[model samples]
Target: MRAPVAMKKVVISLFAILAGTSFALAADTGCDAFKWPVEREQALFPSAPAAQSGAALTVGEAVDFSLAAVDTISFEVPPGHAPAAGTFGATARVTVPPEGELQFSLSDDAWIDVVQDGKTVKSAAFSGVKNCPGIRKSLRFKLAGGAAIIQLSGAKKADLKVAVLTPE
Candidate 1:
């Protein structure tokens, strides 16, 4: 059996090992700004769009916002997960503006796969991502004149929640 301190040490060691040289640094602005992108709140395609399932964050270029820092981002998935069924993923473009390197990170148990300028840049698997418990995930992107759709995926769509976009 491992003591609480030992368990924490193991987790921290794992995080430090994977995070490389910046595991202790927090986003300059905040942490509660990774909700839906600044776009129209609608389901994808004509097909239900998987609500209570996942959200498509449509981010526009030339737009920047601030966030309130948090501790973690929790993610929860269905009982059994499979690939062929596509474990709830999302899609988004970088929008028209052509800028710099867009950074993205995740909180809780959720994960994000980014498609920049019509190409896949990064993908991550966050653990224990649940309904808006905590969100410290951060990702930045360089504008490229178009739109970016950030599709989210996991076990249960309703189980995950990041900082939702301020209602417009």
Candidate 2:
């Protein structure tokens, strides 16, 4: 009788622990917590094809870029923040339409600067969350629409996945 009761208690404790773990996992993947829906970006991240650094980027395409040391790439405009030693960076070009609000999503934490006509385009808004599975940060820029350079710097990793999206 005593052995059976002890066994039952152990089973109940194990179930409770499993339940809590499941809940935590669910919360970590709650990517919808962003200000706007990120379903398109989220879906593209997993299978997006890789593109060379400095390649021309298309709107709504997620591309993985291989980064070099910060000192190696020649940025169209100086990076908004000076990259510290050991940081990685890269650059790419894109064309924006007039009166457009573009959202740039990144797979890892990094500093993003949009330069058009020799000036840095100011970001209209930004959002970031750690619990989101793939994307780590996003920035929305209001641009006059022309050729622009996307300067990515101060990243901790050597490779980054990025998507330039026109929000839905």
Candidate 3:
């Protein structure tokens, strides 16, 4: 009976040590262990003709904006015109200058897709970063001077910073 009790104690001790070690390893690896709650606020979409509209952005300019979890912004095409989807996350239109080139970058924890003429031209996934805890990505494209749309989406509770740079 004494020998059996001693063996049981040893087994329990080993189990505890193993569990602790596993937890430490997971922490060190920066595992995505927590989920953030999504906000219930409605997304804002400015009118196409508004001064704040993406279509108002001129060539050789850069626009920076922040997006909340599950939020999206659409740019209207053909400078100063509204998108068919209304003022919602569906689409944003911007007139790319003739032979113009644009560069786009996003902070960690967000996804971006660019659509032109109903086709997806550029897409990138969000990656994890040690310092920022989000993804960093960039894409460049040449335009033929017409309407183009930029769509942005992000994870729950995660906010993202996006920058759009146009050629000078």
Candidate 4:
């Protein structure tokens, strides 16, 4: 009887070990699966300018648009740090085609400023919209053909999508 009890204990311990190992392997495999998609995006949009960190913006074939991570952006907090803590930012160089309008949109939780020729054309802060549902703000500006800089800032790390549209 003592021998049988010892054998049973050993079997249970082996089963627990196997189960834990399997779970760990599955978790690692799942993380690896997500890496490929990010790698593919980086390969396809090789020409896009690199952000301070994270992935580079992907320029759409038909339209000039970029989806970028906010955490990678390097933001400069005001001297007084008026905004709440945890603010970050990034800038992107965009080309505005003739007769095209630059449409900048971001999650309601973020703040954005579009500047051209050292002039701030549009700026907004939506921090008060916490209770609002799906509250995304977009600003459209008539852009002349040439280079433009977009400055983005936010209190939280999130993704920002920017697009430039031309008349069909």
Candidate 2, lDDT over the whole model: 0.87
The residue ranges of model 4 lying beyond 4 angstroms of the native Cα positions read: 1-83, 123-135
After superposition, the stretches of candidate 1 with alpha carbons farther than 4 Å from their true spots are 1-87, 91-107, 123-133, 155-157, 162-168
Q: RMSD in Å for candidate 2, one decimal?
A: 4.7
In angstroms, the error of model 2 at 80 is 1.0
- Give Cα distance to truth, residue 116, candidate 3, Å: 1.2
Q: What lDDT does each candidate get?
A: 0.36, 0.87, 0.44, 0.45
The TM-score values for the models, in the order shown, are 0.34, 0.81, 0.42, 0.44
Write one digit per residue (lDDT tens) for candidate 2, span 10-116.
99999999999998877655576677777888899898887776888899898988888989989988888998889998899999977677999999888999998
Top candidate on TM-score is: 2
Instruction: Quote the lDDT for 33 in model 3.
Output: 27
> In candidate 4, how many Å is residue 3 off?
85
lDDT of 4 at 49: 39
lDDT per residue for candidate 1 within 1-168, as digits (tens), equals 757998999999998877864534333123223343422211211221223322333332111111111112222322122222423333233333344334443333434544454454443322221332234344444434455545455523323333322122
lDDT, ranked from best to worst? 2, 4, 3, 1
Positional deviation of residue 51's Cα in model 3 after best superposition, in angstroms: 11
Superior by lDDT: candidate 1 or candidate 2:
2
How displaced is residue 150 in candidate 4, in Å?
A: 0.4
Judging by lDDT against the true structure, name the best candidate: 2
- lDDT tens readout by residue for model 4, 51-87: 4422323223211223345455553332122334555
